[model samples]
Target: MSSSDGTAADASWERSDGRSRPPPTVNTIRRIRQACTNCRHRKTRCSGERPRCMNCRRVDRVCHYEPYSTTNPPSSASVAANNGAAKGKSPSSLFPRAGVVDISRLPLATRKSRQSSPSHRLLSINIRLPPPSPQTPFPTCQVQCMRFTTAPPPAVMDHLIDAYFLHVHNQPYSYFHEQSFRERVNYGLIPKCLLFAILASALKFSDIEYFQGSIREATEAYAREAWLAILHEHLTVENNPTLAERTLTLLTLFYIGGRTSSGWLKIGLAVRIAQDLQLMREPKNTMPPIEQEEHRRAFWSIYLLDKLVSVGQSRPPAIAEEDIHVQLPSDEETLRRGIWKKTPTLHQLINWKSETESSVNGTFTQTILAATALGRCCRYVLHGREMDEMPPWDPRSDFTLLNTFLLLIDHHLQVETPSIPQIVEHYRRPDGTLDFQSLEHVVFARIVFHTAHCLLNHPFLLRMRLQKSNCKVPPKFLTRSFQISCNHARSISSLVEDAIASGCHVQSSFYAYASILAGGILSLAIHIDQEKGQVTDPETLNHYQKAIHILERTGRRWDHASKMVSLHCLFRAIL
Candidate 1:
């Protein structure tokens, strides 16, 4: 029988019956080697890396390097754990029971484990935010759980994106030196996204007065065309089909001025490019032109276009009663005034339609006619045209128009996934880190600015209605008016303050826009007071203070003289 410590009187353990045990062998030592290192120790043949040995590696632990004698006999437990192979298994044995790993067989998995370092992980996490990383911000198929609720503000995210774009393009914002810019261009850095942002912003918000007053005087059609040509030339030079596809998607959301058929055609062009580049589809050996790939683009285009158009119709500008002259059309001249007219009273045009069936070039005659009619109306309002007669335009109910526009905007937001909030949180680490703090500031500024600007300063709508005199008024109308005015003022002020605090550089054009928006909101608040007999509520006072703070901060950076004028008007009207 074996001794109580389970060792025999030999180098290898033996049974109590007195047979000689084998010597401790290389196989046993090698098993111990792996077990030790895994446990980060030297070779020992014990079961616990706690006591690390050959037994330890098999049991998944380090082999302990204690002073246990190399001459000590193997225990029954150790031999049993090794399935009796420890005593006799050959060094060349492919199937050793001692848990020795084959280094050669593990080459691929080990290489992969080595390649996936921490930096790669961080980059993978960064790109999922709706704005994407600046270098390659396109969304991947990877889905990850995120920590935050809501998205990073768009203005802030845009800055981060811009930084990334600059880095990728290797274009330094530091120097406007033409040679440096050209060098970066040669290195494949074209500011496609930056240019796109500028154009889109101009298209969407450029007032006719601003266009006529400034741009028309400075730049001709040839200059604009040349700029576009440069962009096109770079897109060709880059041969970057993916970038082209992304550009198409952006244009679809922001521009691409047709509905239905034309939209489908444009989308078809995107899909064809995508196919050629294998971006959205498996490329066949051959490719087809836009006309041939009609089916691919038609479905998404029709669906997205209809969705966008409906949304556009919903956000019809809110008109007020006092802005329009109460009169009927007498002739074409009078009709022109009627076309420019705002609703003299809120419900007077409630039965009028915003859209009507008409013919354009083989496309959305209704949308084109509606846009043209609306544009004409807004022009008349801006020009202070004679308000003698109603126009020849068909009556479109205000409800129809407002609902359609809202729906279109909603659809675009959903499809585009721009500035999606939740995706941004995924980029943070476990302790909740964030990059591009400036992005947050810029985004918040833009949002607040747009909200206030669109509500207060849109040429077609009267968001604020100033009474000629604040004398007798119905209580309900007054209360409703106050509620709208107070809430909007508070919201605008709060957003502006938050934006400024985010450390958005006050000198940015975006910051200037925010200042302008604040000024307009303040003007609206003052107008509300004028309508209420020069009486300012506590909420109004609070909003005024907030607006003052924004002006003080932002004015230090931008020469917002027009904004100051608006602020002055606000004080005069209210006080």
Candidate 2:
């Protein structure tokens, strides 16, 4: 053989000798079995320690292994046997029976058994088990049921309830008592529909945009659920319609938050229900003090709602003054202390002396009384004389109704005047703006009074203008009434601006209504000045602009504000 060929053979032999040989049989190294089922499902690395693996131990999961079986499939009869053996045993507890043990006691035993088991034993006994039932994902838990029906988490619910009481229930005309309401909510005694209504109303005032969206959704859901619940209860329940009254009240409040006309209709239903419950009449002597107080509160609340709706809508009041025999509510302290004092009627309250006074000095009760009186005057002005009955030809007959309303106004002023100075002293700020938060009841009362005054006198002023056109001199009372009405209009506009400047959260509807009324009057005054070829007062024009600004601000929260703005524009154009 040539040396080169020998060298090549030697080199091949040397390379073969230097390189390690592959396994003779090419035996496959089994992939190390994956960690237990849980760790594998979680896609986490597992220590592969037998029995309960490290990952499962850390998370307290049921660590399990699959048993190795031959590649040949099991017989159907063996499968049937296994199924039969598993009968009556829960899937979780299908291991060999040690005894009928309480599952509660298994945890300690499980830990000890897992700790004491030999590694070899754990590896040998790879008991296969069925997969766990599918779990609800965490996000799905948030909206498990209908969003409205689902109870909020306890902390969130508590916060909402607190916000409702703080911002809503403390309003001058609101009726809810915080302590009783909280107790009812905590005990889950409030019906779900009513609770949702309250939540929707409360959330309307939340500063958060998320909560505002929630309010819109919740309000729609509440309307559906409330109607259904009411129908169901009416069919299934026997007497006692107290729930109906409460549900109606909550529905009214929800509508009120939106400043919808539907709130007035809801309040009418609430009034009828209250009447059915005998809440309009004085409570019986035999009734418990708390029950009596509750009746008084409910009745007056309905009365307050009637006034607010009537004035806001420019409609006649649904509740009449004579029909309300229930007394004013007692102070919170008096009610809380369980002291039973003889509640007084409106007449008696007007005549109350220092010696005879009970603790009826509560802002809520006082405000209701003032509003009720103002409401009476408003009804007379709006609907007292049926125009249908009036002779079509006589302008003189119009003055007859005006004269009577003026007397009623005089009576109210006389009774209410004594309290006005005190209210002014308490609420007037150093900057001459009224601090509405400190005296919301008084501020609202004054606004209502002035609104009624302006409304009543406006017709007479129009009459005076017509008479002036006919070359008939206007009566002294007519001219005086015109001047007084203009003064009241200016006063209302100033008060509203002051309220806005002071950062008071007065009801948007109230301020909006007052602004439109005042603005209309001031605009009329400007038109009259232009007709006389006199220069328009810049101050009056400025006041009208401010009133319009208020309406625009109110439009953000109240639907009625937009309507009022449209109406004011039409009226201004006509003038």
Candidate 3:
């Protein structure tokens, strides 16, 4: 301003003087046109330059100038519109915002995003399909939307499904029915939660390590999605009992992948749902053959799980023996072929003998029967001890009840004993190592049976110890019980070592529990022998060390195994 005014005044004075004024002395100075966004927001001066100015470069800030325009700058919306125009599309069409779908255009239950990756995509694809009208056999629109949103490529889905059936479903205690599950997946009739659970389980069992790292993340994401879907759809067992039960069962497995406590919680929910569906009762003969068989299988599966979980967690069984009227499950082949056959109850099977084979022959039917007996024995022992320890207890009455239970367990063991030699012969190879893959279920069953025997006789052995300590001669029956308990404990340890040598210990969940049980008994025996000034057997000490090693290896995969290992170490130190 000073230069311009001074030059104008000098020019005006020269003109007034009517003389040709020499060019007014002028000074050239460059003015800044604009500042960068950072400088302008900070109210700092900036030299306008092509890339960066000295002021911005000195302070390590980016410098930029607004475009020179005679007209006003365009708004965000206008800029977006120009972008859309350049791409030959409307702005609204280019940017598809969530929650913009018209609710009135679809059924209330079908109001979910069809886009593959929604903000809540990992929550669950739990959108409920509207009930089909008499005019329509299926809710086509809902099914279509579900497929579009949650279903993976057919090839990938097929591989995962096959993997699950091969690795998980084929296990003796698994609950899923292959034919029905396959149909549901093929037709997109499965719930999103179940689908994700299946995928998570399959991925977990995949041998590829790269995929295993992803498995945990994918499982968590799918689990969250499934839960969100449940909430959004307001799913209840009353409205959809079948889906609810299936989802709960799959969720139990999902929890078993990492969180043992949560797995138990899901198993509890599954039990309640099974009861709600009247799965405790045998199916009526009037129902379709497939439905009848499926009902029977489902009930028995839940029963097996109830017993397994009870024994595994050292808790009482949820499905009472008296409450179940459903028959035992048939062999896998018969079930797979959809052949329905009436089977005897577990109690009847306990007394029933096969003339062709005196003991359980490692068949699925026989294994489950043995498991049922073992479960009952475990419960009786656990409950009997509780009763004996209760305030105002009658020692004579409790002892009588305990003895009666022991006699019953003894009879059950006698019936199951002959199968042991037969199983060992069947699975042993020429080289003398057990065929682990083929015999894992059989070995696990044997371990459970023997462990139950040990548990049943341990208390009697303790009584004998007390009697001996008091210088009173123990009864012949008490001495026999002690010897039998030691034999069973030794057998358990032998089986664990065999399984480990076969490289199949990790394949079964029972391995860790069986190892801990056997090790604890051996440790107790060693402690007792030491207190009596008797030399501890070298073989027994070796078995205890082997048990510790097995638990250490198992701990790498299961948190429960690690805890058991710690407890075993502490107990050993104390002894």
Q: Point out the worst 10-residue segment of candidate 1 by lDDT.
A: 142-151
Per-residue C-alpha lDDT of model 2 across residues 89-122, encoded as one tens digit per residue? 5432432212112222235554355346443133
Using all chains and alpha carbons, the TM-scores for the candidates as numbered come to 0.30, 0.63, 0.61
Q: Residues 122-178, candidate 3, lDDT per residue (tens digit)?
A: 222222233334477554443332232333344456777776766555344555557
- Number of clashing residue pairs, candidate 2: 0
Worst 10 residues of 3 by lDDT: 94-103
lDDT of 1 by residue, 226-296 (tens): 23433455346766554454445434433333233443344555556654554322223254322112222
The true-versus-predicted C-alpha distance at residue 460 of model 2, in Å, is: 7.5
Model 3 spans with C-alpha error above 4 angstroms: 1-159, 170-172, 209-212, 223-238, 253-260, 286-291, 312-314, 351-362, 383-440, 459-480, 499-506, 573-575
Q: Decide which is better by lDDT, 1 or 2.
A: 2
The numbered model that scores best in lDDT is 2
Query: Residue 134, candidate 2: how far off, in angstroms?
Result: 27
| Clashes in predicted model 1 | 44
Q: Which residues of candidate 2, in runs, are more than 4 Å off?
A: 1-145, 209-214, 234-236, 256-261, 285-288, 312-314, 336-338, 350-360, 387-438, 460-473, 500-503, 566-575
